[model samples]
Target: MKFGIIGTGTVGTAIAVRLVEAGYQCLGVETRSARSYARFRQYLNRDRMPLESWVPEADLIFITTQDGMIGSAAKNLADRKLYKDGQIWIHCSGSQKAQILKEDPALPVKTLSMHPIQTFADVGEALKLLPGSHFGLEGEAVEEGIQIVWDLGGIPHRLDPEGKPLYHAGSVMASNYIVALADMAVQLFNLAGIPKEAALESLIPLMQGTLRNLEKVGLPQALTGPIARGDSEVVRSHLECIPLELQQAYRALGRSTLELAQAKMKLNGKEYPRQDLQILNYLLDGGKEKNNHGNCRENIRSKRNYC
Candidate 1:
């Protein structure tokens, strides 16, 4: 299929590069800046062209602009009668529904949302990381979008348009929050008088190891550390050592981790000492623990009615 990308940012360049490699025709790129044209010259077909001129040349038109611009751009395209009956209009927004492009249900163009759930640090990183990445797809040409993902050597996951917000939230927690957590880890290392260069070197391997464990064992089985073992003293020691804000954050995360710990214990036919469990939960919730921790271990293991 002939595909023209409207934006020439990381995603746009990456998609165009992969599509061209996958034997898809590149109609042309439509961009405002000469720098972007200069930047992604290898991927863009022909040259930078007017949006109107570019729209008609492709079977698929990808509006890879910023989130705020997507709706306006799609509306402008529809208003100008630039889209044809059978042309597919797609965007790579993780949070937006396909309707952002097909605002006018009367328009004959098939609309879609095809978002790659991967971080793009740079064009080079995007080019390398996109393959085997998972994409969230929705709307009229979902199958076609899935084919494009497969052509890129990526995995495709279907999504309901109404659930895009929650789906995006999960992606944000997984990707963006992990970055924030990494920053926090660096901050802790900094407090210990460690240089960022040294700290990052030490920390990245630990993070990568956790990821490897995640892929290898999956879920509760992948979870480790003091929380998994229900070691109340260790958690309390960690809380005392960290700053107040980190302590709060630790408590919040530990609350969630406790559930996973319970699951792990059940799966392994193991039980945590009730006193140790109670102390940890009390620490997590500021002296409040959930639903009779004194009996939680036996309740979880014997009856399987986990607290």
Candidate 2:
């Protein structure tokens, strides 16, 4: 199929290169900035004509522009009557639904969003990573457009249009938050006199092992360490060791761990030892003076059913 890429950013370039390599005809690319146009020229076939003259020739168009620029770009293309009937327009933004292209109501075009669940530091790296990635697709014309993802060696999963934000949030948690959490780990390692590079290297094995465990056992069952074991003393020590600025993050993760532990049957419904429970309650309660009058012992008593 002939494809046109509307933005020459990292993702757009990567997608263009992939399509070209896969023997799909890449008609041309369009970008508003002169600098971006220069960048696109580098990767594109020098003999090919400019995008303004090529868009009308494409059977499929990829609106791979920045999230904020997608609607305007689509409208501009529609204004020029660039797309023909039965043409397909796909965007790569996870947070955006296909409705963004509704600005061109007269066009008999199929619009869809296909967001790959992978990070692209650059075009070259993205090209190497695109294969086998899961793509979240949503639109009125999803089935027909999904062939593009499949051609790129990606798995396509349909998502509800209204659930796009939540789906995107989940991806952010998995990809972006993991990076933030890694930074936090590196900071903690610095306290132990390990240099940033060394700390990052040291954590690689642990990260790989944790990933393996998740793959093998999944979620709460894969959970380990103090929270899973209901070792309130270790939990308390962790709280004490964390810096004041990071205490809230620690507490929040700890509470989440507790919830997971309970769900996994690691912790009984009854609370543990009174002293341990007191420490946990104190840490979880944000230093509030809330009463801990419930059955702490009963929480631990429920653990017998877990095994």
Candidate 3:
């Protein structure tokens, strides 16, 4: 099948290069910027053709522009009446639904969203990461999109249009939030007098090991450290020592982690003693009280169910 790409960014260039390598003919690319077009041509050795000439001729058209411009790009061709009856129109945005291509229910062409769930820093990275990546697919041409993903050596996951936001949220937490958590760890290490560079070097291996544990043992089982062991004293120490700015975030994460600890204990046919569980929950919940030793005390004075 012949394919034309309407954007000349990293994704578009990488897709064109891979598709040509997969024996798909190129109907040429379309882009407004001369610099982008030059880069696209450099990668694929294909001429930049006008929209009027390529849209009707190509079997597949990829609108690989940034998220905000996808609708405009599709509208441009739709207004020009350039789309053919059986052609496939696709976008690579993770969060946008394919229906943005055309709102008309009777539109003859098949519109689809085929988002590769991987990060790309450049064209080379995109080409390297695109294969074996999971793609979230939706819209009218899902079966055809699945075949296209197979051609690109990608895994395909069918998604409901209504679920696109949540799907993309999970991807963001997995990819982007990891970076944020690493930064937070580094900041705490710096506060402890560790150099930023040294802290990062030490933290990287620990993070990698945690990821390996997750892959090997799977969730709930992979959870570790003080909370997993129901060590309320350690958690109380953390709350007292950490900066006030970070306490809320730590407590929020701890609350969620405590639930995982409960699950892990249940899976092992063991559970935290009721007093221990209540103390851990109270510490994570930011309850403040003084015991006889002038230290933070658990909410044992109240008859409330911390569970």
Candidate 4:
């Protein structure tokens, strides 16, 4: 299949290079800025051309622009009557739906939104991580367009257009939120006088082990540590040691961990000795607190066999 890439950012260049390497013809790339055009040329080893020139030459076009620019770019292309009938136009924006491309009725393209569920810090690393990642696809042409995902060694999952924002939010929680949590961990380690690099190096093994446990055992079954053990003293100590700036985050995560532990049958009906429960209550009672006792008991009974 012949491919034309618009925007020429990291995602666009990475997909373009992968397509070329897989023996698909990459017709050309288009970008609005000189710097982006230069970067695209350097990464794809192809010259930048006008959108009008490139859009009509390929059977498929990828509009891998920033989320805000995608609609405008699509309109611009449609105004020029750039798309040929039967051509497929796909965007890599996780939060956008295929309907964005249908803004102009003059464009007879088969529109689809195909978002790779992986971070692309740069084109080089993105190319290496492309294979085996998930791609969320939405549009009428989904089945036909999914072949390109498979050709690129990716798994394609169908998503409802209405749920695009929610799907993208979940991805952000999984990918971006993890990074923020890691930063919090690093900050705690720094407070303990460990160098940033040393802290990260020390935590790598624990993080890997946790991920392995998740992969092997999954969710509540993989949960461990103080919360899982219902060790109120350790939990109290954690709350006491957390700085003011991080206290809220610690409490939020603790509540989540407590719920997970309860779901896993790790927390018994009797609160951790009164002193421990007192400390937990002090930490978690302030904001929208819910009665966890009944829910905890129900979860324990339901998953008793797992314990």
Candidate 5:
């Protein structure tokens, strides 16, 4: 199949090169920046062509533009009548639905959103990470998208269009939040008198172990530490030592962890002692409304089988 790309950014260049290596014909790339096109040509070894020269001829076209520009790019191509009938148009925006490309009903093209569920720092990183990565597929051309992803050695998952935002949010939470979490851990280590330089280094193995656990055992089972152990005292000490602003995040995560802990306990045919569970809830809930025992019990009891 002949394929062309509209944006020659990191993702666009990577996809183009990989597709070519996988035996797809390159109709060439179209981009606004000279530097980006230069980089694309450096790896792709293909000519930079005008949109009119390639878009109508390619059987598949990827609009791998920045998330914000995808809609406008698709609209422009549709408006200029560059897309031919039955051609497949795709975007790699995690948060956008395929309908963004089908704004004109009479366009006669198949629209698809195929987002890689992996992070790429550059074209090289993207090329290395694209294979064996999962791609979220949504739109009228889902079957075609799956075939293309498989051809690129990627796993494809069909997703509900309405859930695209939530799906992207989960991806961001897993990718971006890991960095934020590491920073937070390093800060806490600094507060604990660990040298700033040594904080992240020390934390890396611990984080890696946790990731290994997740990979090996999966959720609830993989969860560990004070919250997972129902150690209300340890949690309370953490809140007391952690700065107030940081405590808000700690407490929020504690509550979520508490839910997982409860699930783990149930899975093991165990349960938290009533008082321990209540105290854990109270601490994680910020000890707010001290007199609202009924509210606390209702909330906890409603969500936990052990309660």
Candidate 6:
């Protein structure tokens, strides 16, 4: 496909590199600065043309701008009457839907939203992480988008348009919140007299090993630690030691972890007695148990059984 990249940012540059390496023709790029334009020019080894000039020539165009600007860029293209029938317009937005590209339905162009599930710390990181990563896709041209993902050696997963918020929330939890979690870990390390500088170095192996476990056994089977063992005393002790600001987060995560632990027990054919799980739940939820024991019981029972 002859592709044109709009906005030569980290994502756009990484994608452009992949496209050219995969033997796709990058017609040109539209960038905000001379530096960005020059950078993409070297990567594409082609002229950096204006958006209106290139949009008409390419079979596929990537609006790889910020989530907020993607709609405006597409609308600008429509205003210039550049969209052509049968052309595909793609954006790597986790939050926005494909409809963002259809600023003018008169053009009959196809819009596709293909978001990488992995984080891109930079263009280099993006290139390294994008391959073998999963792409959350939502669009009319899903098959076309999937082919593009495959070309980049990424796995494509379809997403419902209505569930965009929830889907992106999963991404935020997985990618963005890891930093928050690392910060929390660093604070605890500091309490133990471990320097903040060394905290991540010490923790990285543990995190990597946990990730490997998840890949090897998948969820429920991969679960471990205090909640998995149905150890209420340990859980309570952790709640006591963790900082006050993190208490609610700890509890919320603990409640969900308990569910996973319950499933693990069932899957492994080692039943955790309901009373033991109940004790852990009571500790995690605190006053919620007092307020509505029946509702809490219903909530626990309503959770999926992995076995």
Question: What's the true lDDT of residue 143 in model 3?
Answer: 97
lDDT at position 157, candidate 6: 95
The pairs that clash in candidate 1 are none
Q: lDDT (0-100) at residue 84 of candidate 4?
A: 88
**Candidate 6: regions farther than 4 A off:** 287-307
* lDDT for each residue of candidate 6 in 81-101, tens digit (9 for 90 to 100): 887789999999999999988
Tens digits of per-residue lDDT, candidate 5, 18-76, equal 88889999986888989998898789788776789888889998998888888899999
User: Candidate 5: which stretches are off by over 4 Å?
Assistant: 288-307
Better of 3 and 4 by TM-score: 3
Worst 10 residues of 5 by lDDT: 298-307
Poorest stretch of ten by lDDT in candidate 4: 298-307
Model 4, position 265, has a per-residue lDDT of 69
The CA lDDT of each predicted structure is 0.85, 0.78, 0.87, 0.80, 0.87, 0.82
Off by over 4 Å in 4: 266-282, 287-307
Model 4, global lDDT: 0.80
How well is each residue in 33-57 modelled by candidate 3, as lDDT tens digits?
Answer: 8988887777888787678877898
lDDT tens digits by residue: candidate 1, 117-221 = 999988899999999899999999998888889999899999998899999999999999998888889877766668778988899999999999999999989
Question: Which one wins by TM-score: 2 or 5?
Answer: 5
Q: What root-mean-square deviation over C-alphas does model 2 reach?
A: 7.9
TM-scores of the models, in the order given: 0.90, 0.85, 0.92, 0.84, 0.92, 0.89
Superior candidate under lDDT, 1 versus 3 = 3
- Let me know the TM-score candidate 4 reaches against the reference structure: 0.84
